[model samples]
Target chain A: MPALKKKITKPPTAARMVEDIIGCKWSLTVLSLVRSGVKRPGAMQRRVEGLTAKVLNERLRKLLRYEIIEREVFAEVPPRVEYRLTEFGNRFGAVIDQITALDEERS
Target chain B: MPALKKKITKPPTAARMVEDIIGCKWSLTVLSLVRSGVKRPGAMQRRVEGLTAKVLNERLRKLLRYEIIEREVFAEVPPRVEYRLTEFGNRFGAVIDQITALDEERS
Candidate 1:
């Protein structure tokens, strides 16, 4: 088994955390889409434009794991499923918006 | 040759651009380190803590390509080299700072 690194005086910094969140392209885009209410998996797949089913599914699972986005499943013939931003996700969305605004300034 | 897709009415959004920057773990962390004074290749390798030499070199090359950071090479026996963020990089850093601040709020 792989040993876990001991926690030192300081844990990983906030900067590093942000780096991880933004490091995965699908996560960033998926989060943005969820914030915009592209709740259905198919709709979200359409909204992000270039992501393949494999990658989108992977990202969604990770987001669910992170609790940034909540996934809901309904009992129906087709099994309706939806995703929405959690409160934590909203805060993250605000930060992403700021980054978008800055990129706009550059353009 | 892969055919270039025609430019649509809307180009890729600013959010998409930010997504690309943050999507790569190395690029995001590299920009953060360069914003600090860890400019030399060896020093940067140490400060980032876990990146291999190959990845660091790759990220540095990409940053240089983006013109977000400028590289300075001194003519000397050991060939001293350094990197500094350009104005564009400084603006990018500000956006990163906001993201970092948001992460802190959550923590």
Candidate 2:
């Protein structure tokens, strides 16, 4: 019998996951707004400019699924909701800080 | 005359640039390979698996435009061309490290 070659498989890498999350349109914009203190959906929309509410909601849901951000719903007449970064999400700050430093270096 | 609302302009931020570069398909994969010591195009294509040469060239050109990676040409019989991360590109290590840490933490 002939020897069979082992097939190589590439699992979803952490870098790939990170790339997918940020690859979506407005994903980074939404994350940036949330990190900059704009937690409410309405606030993010206003700050981002041109990001439709539908897209914002989609990104928020995806971010939640990835455990990047957490959403809190308050029991109120209007059902207030706020989004914040989780511990894992906060770790992304280091990446953002490095990017900011690079930008500063360029400008 | 009625007062006019100041037009808000959001200049491209460093974080946005970083997102743009990494958002492209195979961008991170190529960078990861290079950072892992696979600096040749042929080696990168082989290691990344499924990345077409055309796409790799495009991503490399974009990365060059962003000043993320620098190219070196060696005078040899085959005219070897190699790519390596620039100082700015090396800074992306922080982001990748954070992502790796997050992945490890999750697992």
Candidate 3:
């Protein structure tokens, strides 16, 4: 078996953590759409122009791995699977709002 | 000559702009160090662990292109060059602070 990667004892700097979360292509766009209530994967793909399903899935998986978002599965007729921001994710939303405000201030 | 990319500009969304600014490797770390008064390029590279001069220069160029940081040159014995955040850059700092705070809150 391949050797497991060493566990990181030192937590990353907050800026580094935030950068990792947002650095991937489509990550921020996916988060923004989720914050705006586009929770379903199909909806998110439709909302973010030019974002392919494959790319969206990748972004969503990353966000899930980071614990920034949570996935809920329902046993309904259509078997719904939806995503929502975790508490941490909501906190991130606040940061995004601040960034948006900064951009507006400059413009 | 290769066709120039068309520039029919409908400006990007605020979230997209913010992501573009922070998405690159070492971009946020460099920005954070600069905001914290590590103004000189050499100083910044020294301060942010694992940041090479080449990577730092690339990030600096991108920041300059975005008008997020301004470069100043002084004609001294060795010719000093330093970077300072623009008005917009300071605004970005506030956003970074918010992200930092959010991280702290969760931890």
Better of 2 and 3 by lDDT: 3
Cand. 2 Cα-lDDT = 0.74
Computed on alpha carbons, the lDDT of every model, listed in order, comes to 0.74, 0.74, 0.76
A best-first ranking of the candidates according to their DockQ comes to 3, 2, 1
Please list the residue runs of candidate 3 whose C-alpha ends up more than 4 Å from where it truly belongs after superposition.
Answer: A1-13, A20-25, A100-107, B1-90
The residue-by-residue lDDT of candidate 1 on A7-94, one tens digit each, is 6654434345344566677778888788778889888777767888898889888777656789889999889999999887676667
lDDT (C-alpha) at residue A93 in model 1? 68
Error of 3 at B86 (Å): 7.1
True contact recovery of candidate 3: 0.58
Every model: Cα RMSD to truth: 9.7, 11.0, 7.2
Docking quality (DockQ) of candidate 3: 0.29
**Candidate 3 residue-wise lDDT, B28-102, digit = tens:** 888877788788988887777899898899998877776778999999989999999998778766775676576
Q: What lDDT is reached at residue B84 by model 3?
A: 91
Q: Per-residue lDDT for A81 in model 3?
A: 95
DockQ (CA atoms), all models: 0.21, 0.25, 0.29
The runs of at least 3 residues in candidate 2 whose Cα sits more than 4 Å from the true structure, single-residue gaps closed, are A1-13, A96-107, B1-89
Candidate 3 per-residue C-alpha lDDT over A1-107 given as tens digits, one digit per residue, 9 for 90 to 100: 99999987665444554556555558888888888888899988777789999889998987887667899999999899999989888877677667656657767
Model 1 chain A: worst 10 consecutive residues (lDDT sum): A10-19
